[model samples]
Target chain A: MIVAERKPFDEIKESIQDYKKVLVVGCGTCVAVCLTGGEKEVGVLSAELKLSQKAESAPAVFGEATVQRQCDFEFLDEIKDIVGEYDALLSMACGAGIQFLAERYPEIPVFPAVDTTFIGVNKDVGWYEERCRACGSCALAMTGGICPVTMCAKSLFNGPCGGTNQGSCEINKDQPCAWYMIHERLSKQGRLDNIMKICPPNDWRNQTPQTLIQPGYEERIESSK
Target chain B: MKSGSQLEKILTAGHFAFTGELGPPRGTNIEAIKKKAAPLKGMVDAVNITDNQTAVVRMSSMAASLFAIAEGLEPNYQMVCRDRNRLAMQGDILGAYAHGIRNMLCLSGDHQQFGDHPQSKGVFDIDSTQLINMVKNMRDEGTFLNGQEIDEPPKMFIGAAANPFAEPFEWRIFRLAKKIQAGADFVQTQCVFNMERMREWIKRANDMGLSEKAYILPGVTPMKSLGMARYMKAKVPGMDVPDYVIDRLKGVDKKDQADEGIKMACEQIAEFKEMKGVAGVHLMAIEWEHKVPEIAERAGMLPRPQV
Candidate 1:
């Protein structure tokens, strides 16, 4: 669930001010769940943009289209016949989908209508809040299902911070101190002593400085060649 | 404060003009009532404070408008029957006029579930058409929904919203006519975009001979950014956007998209001005009030008529 916020109209209008022919592409995946990139959203934005810029270009350029998912090659293929007609592509998908569209249709440029926020789930309709950080690691078992890395704000692994008050995080009063929740969960499960063990100031290289993984099955063939 | 009849003006001028919109809070904070009403004053001829817009509970429309008038922004008391019934609706209409709120934007309102409170019960006393007719009866005929004559009729400017870009365009046109026939003095449409479709809708209005019978104001909200455009199109009901607009959103740097949005909106408003049968443009610059003057200026719609 890649959460994203729809950019304001003025900013979106400026991006395409020069182009007469434009195609709005909607993705029906992570972006849709967060209410940013969806078919309905694509329709609304298309209408809005027209109302925003009443001027039309020669040969009558400007229209809208939606794909099942811009990230997937199959969906991109669906728009194959009509791809060349569009001068530009406005993708309502996540950053990944935008790049995929760029690669699929290199002739035309792709723009983002949403500020891809993070991976999160809809608490309910019209609401989505961040949850997981997707740190490429799973430590839910030891931490009693709470990922202290993301929830702690500071990403602390030890017990509650010295400034934690009434189980609230010192960094943000609205947030529940992740360590406190971890402590309570671990204590209830008779694993409170796990806090005594040190994991050593996590290897900075593994935690940050950027890392990438190549597919073992696919990339191995290329490397071997 | 003697105000000429908006209805009489519409009927006489053959075309009427009015700036329409509901006032949103100045900020997220809600500490004092006066702090809330400060910005809306003297900005709009009549401030329309919606009843729990977005279904998110805040201040009641009536109470907020009551406060709005107190602060000197002529309040257009939007009375939606989404949460009230025939009895309550009639009572509120009378209540609002008593409160000095003369203008109204009638709506069926977004589903309560769509708002923050999903479990909130819906009280659809009457659909927007029936509600409009009811108010018309009270205003013109001085009769309640029950056919009882009132000592004094409520004087209100009944304004309705239509979404020209609503899908299955035929239905949208048909509904707009229905609202006008039901005695809507003026209409403030859902944000207009897709100029071709709006032109088509206006053509349909011409066909229906409503090209002159009613005041049809096309709604336009300048998309402030690509992100905001996405939110409105995806989140709002009965909103439509074409692929071209979305594609236009593409190829732009995020940091610069806002400027792009403003430019696009100016062009749209200019085009809207050119279109025949379009009475006016309802600018819904949700939270982007500061940029509206620039939008109006650039669109060549600066120095808006003194409505």
Candidate 2:
């Protein structure tokens, strides 16, 4: 899931101070699951903002709203009427959703209330760890399903470097060495010979911002063009 | 005679080689490089100029190698993948070769988190294995990584590092084999304080026939003091400083610890000469270059073999 963390309250407060009415919009999908931006979080932030504004001489009104997913235009349409009442929108969503909201409403300035961290899995209620970098090309097959591109400190394609210390990365003792795990997994599967093969330098040109058209959707892009 | 480097000639001629390391000063101090290279000249086969070792920025190994050359020392210029991409790496390799550097060690450098510039972005576009292969192709095929032909290829005697003490201990030898397969002409191992483990790793490399494929040089760094031993054992990653070594250092007087460290290093060199599949010893007297000559003399490695 796309993990995110709420930006500091001070920064969010400062961004919306100029506006008299600020609507805090939330996303109900990835950010909600990660416990960063959801309906309840929007309420909490709205109440805090209200209290903070009241403490100051110039008080600003804050409103709250959440949609199923801010990335979709259909869910965004549900808030079209209320969005007109606010001078600014403080979006509590990932970078993608925040941009989508800004695109949906061109008049009101949209501000991000959370920092989109990474594509990760929720380890616990409050803990998450990154698992993939989406580097375009994947080498999981030869690497025994371990993603060296994301796991190794140096993103090593070949075997572990001299920095592997007791099956852990040299950068930190808690982080397991990706190549060490790959070696163990391949050795168990009797495919240790896979590690002997040299992996060429990754073709990083695939990482450019690409408009990926799925195979069956190519005709749609052509027709639209 | 790959690159016809002095280290390569010595190793190729079936002579037991000896190499020392020189860490470039943190600033542009040409005299520092010359001073460090002074004692290593005529005492070892070649001197390895480290590249931002331990993540601390220093004079680049390529530039320092030229200074070492001026001091009558052959330098094995070290290149790490941490700071440069393929473009910079290839460019530096060409420039180093143009400056008469024939030996190069490809390494996945220490993470930038361990360096002075902890916030610096590491550009590890290619890991050490890929770097080794890239250099080999540039040397053998006379082509760039893009397969474009080069007008003049850098014919470097490529070297890579090996750690026999790092864990998944059983896999260290296989890693060494993988490095050799990736075109490492010579291998310099991490410091060896645990002789038993080093023996096992070397024996396994021999069993896998890796010894014949590449010249293996076991690294030895004399522990300057008891504190240094403890720091290495506790702080340095992948370092295996045995309890006995620390205990030996602790048994000596505080003033004599440096001498004791030198004594232990000499003893290890003597054992390395007798060990099978061990072609040489890379003595790294970190910041103590003056002691290298004495250690080499005591170890009977003085009057370096003229290949």
Candidate 3:
């Protein structure tokens, strides 16, 4: 899932300071699961903004709205009637959803309230760890399901780069060396020979901004073209 | 002779080759390279010019190799995978060979997080193993990594780094074999402070018959002070500074610790000279380049063999 964290209160407050009315919009998907930009978070941010405005004697009004998913135009259409009532929108969603909301409401200035971190999984209630980099090519099969591109500090293909110390990465002792883990897992599976096979340099030309057509839908898009 | 480098010739002739290291100055100071090369010229077979080692910015290793050549010292040009992609690396290799650099060391350099510029991006387009294979293909097959034929490919005596002290110790020898299979003519290992582990690692390499395929030069760095010893033991990654060595330094006076460190390094080199499957000793005197001659002579590696 796309994990995000709320931006600092000061930066969020400053971005909406100029607007007299600001609507705090939240998403109910990934951000909600991570506890960063859910309906409850939006309510808390709205209350805090109102209190901060009152203390500063600023004539700013805080409003709140939550959508099922901000990335979809259908879900976004539900907020269309009330969106024009505010001078600015403070979106608490991932980067994609924030951009979608901005595109949908082109007139109102949209400010991001959260920083989209990475494609990751929730380890615990407030803890998230990055698992993938979307590098366009995946070699997890050869690596015993551990992603070296995302786990190793250097994104090494032929690795354990002399920097694997005590099963930890050279950069930090707390982080497990991705290659070490791969070695252990592969050794257990009797696939140790996989590591010895030299992997050629990755073809990174597909790493640019990519547009994907799902398997069945590819023919549909091609026929339309 | 693959590249006709002096180091390669010495090793190929079954002579115990000795190499020294020269870290280029942070600025554009050709005089520093010349100064460092002076003491090592007659004492060692070749000199390794470091490429922004530890991620600190320095004069380009290729450029420094030219200066080392100007000083009449054969340079083992070091190329790290941290800063360049395949195109730049191949271009630099061709340029270095054109400028008289015959030896090259392929390395996955220290992480940028430990360097002067921690905010910089690392470009590990190819790991050191792939780099070794790439250079080998360019030299032996006369083809680029993309399989394009080169009018004139760089014929370099390729070298790679090994760390016996790194984690998953059982895999270290296998890694060395992989490097040998990747067409490494020679290999310089990580700094060795724990002689016991190094001996076992070397014995394992010999058992696998890997030593016959490539020359193994174990690196030795003399710790200048007790603080340096402690820092290396506790801080440096993939380094194993045995407790006995630290205790030995502690047994000495504060002012005499430098000499004690040199004594330990000389002792290691002496053992490496007699050990089976040991090809040479790579003396990395670090910032204390002036002391390399003294260390080499004391270790009985003086009067370097001429091929």
Candidate 4:
């Protein structure tokens, strides 16, 4: 899921300093699962922002709202009438959701209240780790299902580096070297030959911003036509 | 002559080759390099120019290697994956080779956290194994990493580092074998302060027939003092300095500890010379280059073979 963290309190306060009333919107999808931008997080952040504003002169009023998902226009339209009541909208979703909110309501100033970090998975209750780089081209098939692009510090496609000590990485002692795990996994599966095949340089052009039409939707529309 | 490198010729000639290390000055001072290499010229076959070792910034290894070549000393140019991407790394290979460097050592480099710039990002576009393979591709096939044809690729005798004392010790040999399979012509290990651990690693390497594939030279760092011994044992990661070594260093007088360290290094070299699959000793007298000649002579490795 997409992982994100709340922006620093001071930075958020400064971004909405000019507004007298603000709406804090949270998404219930990936950000909610990661505990970053959920309904409960929206309340907490709104209360904190109110408290911070109260400490300073000319305090602003804040209203909290959460939707099932922020990326879709239908889910965001639920609060269309009340959204104009606030001076600005503070989105607690990932980058996509924040941008979608701005595009939906072109009049109100939309601001992101959280920093989208990466596409990651929750390791534990409060711990999250990045698992995918969304490089547009995946190499998990050859790497024994381990994503080196996201796990390896350098995003190297080849085998482990010399700094791979024990099973941990040289950059951080706590982080396991991704390539080491790849090597071990491939060796266990008797597919060590996969590691020997040199991967070509990554073609990053596939990652340019563009809408990807779902093939399922496309096929359905064609049959109707 | 695979690459016409002095170290390659010496190792291939079936001699107990002796190599030394030279850590370039932190600043741009060629005189410091000349002074360091001067004492190591006649005593060792080739000198390894460390590339910002330990992540503390230093004169570029390529420039220092050219200085070594100018001083009539063969240089084993060391490069790390911590600072450059594939394009820059490949470009440096051509640059270093054009400047008359014949030997190249590929390493993953120490983490930036250990160096002065802890906040800096590490550019490990390729690891040491990949770096070795890339260099081999350039040298053997005359092609860049992108598979593009090069007019004249760099001709280098490639080397890589190994650590026998790292955790999951059993996997170290297999890593070395993988490095050899990746096109490492020679392997220099992390400093061997723990002879028992090194012996076991060497035995496994020989048993696996890794030596037949590449030259394995055990790294030896002469402890300048008891403090150095303790620092390596306590602070340095992956360094397995046994308790007895510290006890032995503590047993010696403070003033005599340096000599004791040299003596201990000589003893290790003498043993490594006879060990099967061991090619030679890579003396890393960190900041104590003057002691190398003395240690080599006492270890019976003097009068380096002229290949």
Candidate 5:
């Protein structure tokens, strides 16, 4: 889930001060699950913005809307009609949604209400810790399905770093050393020998995209085309 | 267990009265906060300085309340348990009292996912009830949880919240009784829109001999528009909105809803204030602080006695 904390009203206040017409857009996916950037949050942000603007010398009220999902083109298309109506777009979506909104509506400036934190799962109602880095590599199979790219603080491919003391990371005592966890899991599986395998760094170009991967097969098969 | 002399006067006076709330600005700008508090300093008896309300992190509530007190506004430092544990909570209660913030309101805060920090873990080592008791133990006995008496125990008039409109209606009165038993000196309830249900609850409090003992102030936040009324009724947890309110909001013109909201709030306040066991009204007004005085006036709760 895309975890976020609501930006304080004053920070958001500065974002929409000069503008009279505004749109507070919420994404109803990962952010919603985490309770950050969702429809209800859009309402709250709208209310906060409304109050902040109303307090200003010349107050402004924002028009609000929520998309089913902000990252998807089809979902974003739903906002096209109302978005242009506003001078600024305050997005409650993740970074991908913010960029997608910017790309979709190049004329309208979009602002993020939430800092797009890493992808993670909710341990409970209020906690959502980050677990994935999306490093464009898959080494979990060799390491008991624990991707050191995302888990290990050092991303050590060989084995746990010396900083892993008593299963706790040196970076922060509260966090369990991810490599140690991997080692323990692998040890249980009699696959601790996998730690000795020498590994090379992953190539990064694929993640940025050489070109948009519009499915050629979806449009038309090569034989038919 | 009464903490301070100033608070002793307010509580012992029977109908416990006089409190306000201050909204911490989204940023750390002092001037920005002054503008927000410009209207609230003297007019309201006490102002609740929220600690990261809705779990949306902001300036520390304790620091802000201390600042408000410096500016001559009696600050009711609202302490939440979502971010702090028993140790920090104990420290804060004592700290607020030393700073001359005579009042404190305890709450189990909204989840952090609702706030800016979605990944931050929540420490709910104590709920609002436990926190209330912790403060009470410190205030009444001057002893820590470990049974050691401090040289000088902090003096703070403690308060807790009651959402009579939030959950199963049957549970609210029981909860209120429980909180009072836990040493809650006063109870400032969540926003009360429907007075019919509230009047009955007030009657129940009186029947249970609680009205005479505890201070129950129904919360009132003026609605800016019909959309807000409906939104709050549906969205805000533990908040109750009657069909008539929704009906009135629906019928009223968009431009005139604030007036309707004020009128509705005044009517609710007037009715609540007159009930046999009622204490007073706690007007939240959200960010519409400007409307609070008017609502208080309309609700006929103004001209508060100088206790």
Candidate 6:
């Protein structure tokens, strides 16, 4: 899942300082599931902004709303009628949701209230660990199901560097070495021989930022005929 | 002979090679490079110029290597993936080679957190292993990373840094072998303070026949004081400073500790000369460059081979 964190209150204040009336829109999907930009967070942030404005005598009136998913136009259409009531919008979702909100409401100024971190898993309550780098080409099968691109400090394809110590990375003693875990798991599965094969340099041309379009979706009418 | 680097020539000629490190100053002081290269003129084969070592900003290693070349010293120019993308790295290789730099050391540099700019982002587009392979491709195949033919590719003698003392001690030799397979012409290990551990690791390298793949040069840094020893033991990651060595330093007088450190380094160098499949010793006397001549002479590395 895409993980994000709420921006600091001071930075958020600066981002929306010019607007007197602002609507804080939260996403109910990825950010909501991660407990970052859910309905509850929108309420909490709206209240905090109100309190800060009251104490500082800042001419800012805060409002709150939550959508199922801000990226989809259908979910955003629900708020189009009421969006004109406010001067600007403070999006409490990931970067994509924030941009989508702006694109849907081109007149109102949109500010991001959260920083999108990475695609990772929630290890425990209030803790998360990154597992993928989205390098486009996945090598999990070759690496015994572990993503060295995100786990290893150097993202080396040919196993660990000389800094792997006692299963910990040389960069930090607290972090576990990605290759050590890969080696152990592969050894358990009697596939240590797989690591001996040298992986060629990563082909990064396929990883550039671009849109993915489903081929058949474009020719649906022709296909039906 | 492959790259015509002095260090490579010395190692290939069956003579024990002696290499030293030259850290460029933090500012644009070109004189510092010349001053550091003076005492190391005839006492060493090639000088390994560091690239923003330990994350601190300094003169570019490529520029410093060029300066060292002007000072009549063969430079083993160092490049780290932390600072540049593959395009910049490939371009720098050609630039360094154009300026008479034939030796190169590829490193996965220290994290930016340890350097002056902790907030700076690191660009590890390619790891050290990939960097080695890339350089090998440029040198042997005469092609850029995109498979475009070059008019005259850089003929670089590739080198890499090794840390035998880091975690999972058994995996160190395997990592070294991987580096060799990745196209490293030589291996320079981290500073060695524990003889038994280094010997055991070297024995494993020999058992695996890794010496035939690349020249192995063990790194040695002379401790200036007891405090330095303790710091390496506790603070430095991937450093193996045994308890006995620290205790030995503690046993000595404060003023004589420097001498004791030199003695210990000389002993390691002597043993490295005798160790089977060992190429030579990489003396790293940080901030104490003037004492290298004395240390090398005492270690019987004086009068460097004229390859």
Worst 10 residues of 4 chain B by lDDT: B166-175
**Local accuracy of candidate 3 as per-residue lDDT tens digits, B115-230:** 99999999988889999999999999999999999889899999999998887999888888888899999999999998889989999999999998999999999999999999
Model 1 residue B91 CA deviation (Å) reads 1.1
Against the hidden reference, what TM-scores do the models get? Answer: 0.53, 0.97, 0.96, 0.90, 0.57, 0.96
- Superposed Cα deviation of residue B90, candidate 5 (Å): 1.3
Please state the error at residue B180 of candidate 1 in Å.
Answer: 1.0
Q: Roughly what TM-score does model 4 have, to 2 decimal places?
A: 0.90
Tens digits of per-residue lDDT for model 5, A110-150: 78788888889899997888877776657788878877766
In candidate 6, what are the lDDT values of residues B95-137, reduced to their tens digit?
Answer: 9998889999999888787789989988878888888989999
In model 5 chain B, the worst 10-residue window by lDDT is: B165-174
True contacts kept of each: 0.00, 0.82, 0.74, 0.32, 0.00, 0.39
**Model 1 C-alpha lDDT per residue in residues A1-225, reported as the tens digit of each score:** 788888898888788777768888888888777677788899889988877666544432556677778779999998889878878888888888888999999989878888888777688998887778676556677788888666764455443433344566643557787867877777689885565443322322333656465666667766877
Model 6 clashes, total count: 4
The lowest-lDDT stretch of 10 consecutive residues in candidate 3 chain A is: A50-59
Better model by lDDT, 1 or 2?
2
The chain A TM-scores for the candidates, taken one by one, are 0.86, 0.94, 0.94, 0.93, 0.88, 0.94
- A48-113 per-residue lDDT for model 4 (tens digits): 988876667677899999999999999999999899899899999999999999999999999999
Where is model 3 more than 4 Å wrong at Cα? A56-58, A222-225
Q: In candidate 5, which residue ranges exceed 4 Å CA deviation?
A: A1-225, B5-8
DockQ, all candidates in order: 0.01, 0.78, 0.76, 0.36, 0.01, 0.52
lDDT of each: 0.68, 0.92, 0.92, 0.87, 0.73, 0.89
User: What tens digits encode model 5's per-residue C-alpha lDDT throughout B70-95?
Assistant: 67777888988678866788777777
Residue A66 lDDT (model 2): 99
Q: How does model 4 fare in lDDT?
A: 0.87
lDDT of 2 by residue, B1-307 (tens): 7799999999999999999999999998777777888888899999999999999989888888989898999999999999999999999999999999999999999999999999999898999989999999999999999999989898999999998988788877877777788899999999999999999898999999999999999999998999999999999999999899999999999999999999999899999999999999999999999888898899999799887
The total of clashing pairs for model 5 equals 12
| By TM-score: ranked, best first | 2, 3, 6, 4, 5, 1
